[model samples]
Target: MLTQLSLPKLQIPFLCHGQFMVRVLVVSQAVAVVLAFAPGVYGDVWARLGFISVFVHWISIITTLCLCAARHKINQLKPISIISVVLCIFLTLTLIVSAVAFSLFSTLFNSINHEMSDFLAKNLMVAFIVALVAVQFLIVHAEKSEQLNAQTHAELNALQARIQPHFLFNTLNTVAELTHIDADAAEKSLLALSALFRAALDVGKLVPLQTELELAKQYLSLEQWRLGRRMNVNWQIPDALPAIQIPALTIQPLLENAIRYGIENSAEVGKLNIFSIESRNALTIVITNPYYQSIKSSGGNGIALDNIRQRLMLQYGSSASLTFGNSEGLYRVKLVIPKS
Candidate 1:
């Protein structure tokens, strides 16, 4: 669904402020209309050319700029309906002003009686086509700008929401217990907790793949300390990790899910596996954990997974993906990122 945001005339967003693109649209449209008026039946050849050159560029550029300004409202209409109505309205306004100016200026400067009806007859259809092209360009550009803004806003909110309260409380409890027995270890745990929270708050930006993997490792280490031998992690990362870029804290939530579903609920020690495979075109990271069958399953939709997918779409378009599957008694997730 489209947003109900409204915009007023003459207020263009920064994305629509490409003056070079606007001028190019104006000049090309102006030349096309001028050529259509070459076989002049009006008074003076040079005067007709000069008047059209001025009028065509003026009308086309203003109409396009104004369309961009009003895009939020205009985009609500259906595609064909918008194109038809926009062309009709702009063409009508353009012809009315051009016809009146033609008569007034010809009479004043050329001292000849030229009819407004003749001017309208000469330029109406050609001006309509030019207006159509200009309006379409602005409409497409404005719509894309709006979409990108909406996605960015959602991604920011997701970043702020991803701070897990349960993780914080559990880690603090572990810190309190460790403080009494092993003061130095407790101090290290407190520092780790603080670092993780700081990283959580500053996500939604890009970082190298190794940095993201390190964050996941930090999180797992803390969880293992709290859970003792019940939580086990096996990392199969390469000595030379890929230098690819990904969103910061991208893998942390997945690790949290692993602990929640696989380790926390189990009576026996549960194992979590982290491994990756790389190819020339893409890299795939696989996470697997033992899922005991005795516990009754609770159904809940995954907000973290949805958030990651949306962020991936915004950053990599269709080049990245997240998928889930199960084999034997183990659950698995695979994340694929393009090398490009």
Candidate 2:
């Protein structure tokens, strides 16, 4: 049921300024109509202006909606530019017919003359043109936004792909190291290694929180087997937080980094703490490991930390954060994911 939802579809948040501008234009037009055309309410320029303004606003909105809908349909065809041009011609014809009908209805049954009707028709035509311009501007703006998002996604996928090889190299080396000392352990490690690689290959760049955490557990199990008593793994995650989604292998790679750095640097066994915090709107995963001061001071390895940051940015843009620093004697990685 959850898989059917396709919840990862990307969308842009609506801007208040854009909505405000549309509202202002709509309100200004409505007010102008009330002032100008109100029968016997005002006997000045305000009345005439109001009459024309309201009419202009109404006509503009209708024409714009028509053009926008037609443009959207045309977009489903071949070239959008060609479709837009054709749609504009159709818009002109629609406006002409509407203006003629409005003028005939107003003049034949009322006090307005042909001269006034002609002026009204001209105003309607101008409104249609204004509406067309607005729709075109909106289309251009939407397309630019989509292109930028596409570029960001492409950069992120490239980053994810680059980070995969480093982990593969490490795992293969571990498998090689364990082969001779304990034949049975090495065979089990190989099986776990195969499962880990298969999961990594089959899973998408992003997955449900439950799926990622499951993968993380499998990964940790394999590492623990390889590291033997030299690695200590501790997990503290509530059951409620499993519903929140995250990038696949996001936590695992960070854990791998911690393990690699901690175990390699420590003369004795090193402890790793993997925990999650579920707040109202965010689910944060913290991976902490004890490291020697020398390893902590050496700083980034250009693999796990940077890779995770790039993936989060690609998936959540500015909405998610990945941070690393030393607190007390432990080096820690904290990934803050927005609650899905």
The TM-scores of all predictions, comma-separated, are 0.56, 0.54
- The positional error of residue 160 in candidate 1, measured at the CA in angstroms, is 5.8
Give the C-alpha miss distance for residue 237 in model 1, angstroms. 0.7
Candidate 2 weakest lDDT stretch, 10 residues: 7-16
How accurate locally, in lDDT, is each candidate?
A: 0.69, 0.63
Q: Quick one: how many clashes does candidate 1 have?
A: 0
Give the per-residue lDDT digits (tens) of candidate 1, residues 83-122: 6567776787687667667756766556235566766765
RMSD of each: 12.6, 10.2
lDDT, candidate 1, at 327 = 75
The candidate that achieves the highest TM-score relative to the unseen native structure: 1
Off by over 4 Å in 2: 1-10, 13-188, 202-204, 293-303
Residues 1-340 of candidate 2: C-alpha lDDT, one tens digit per residue: 2232322332322222345448747765765665456576433555357445655565545544554445434434433444355446545654665566466455433333446557556555654555456545555655654665566556546655765676667677777887867777778777777767766664335578887787788788777766779888888987655466566667777777787677667777788888888787678889888756765555444455775676676555566899988777788888898753
- As a TM-score, model 1 comes out at 0.56
Name the regions of candidate 1 deviating beyond 4 angstroms.
1-163, 292-301
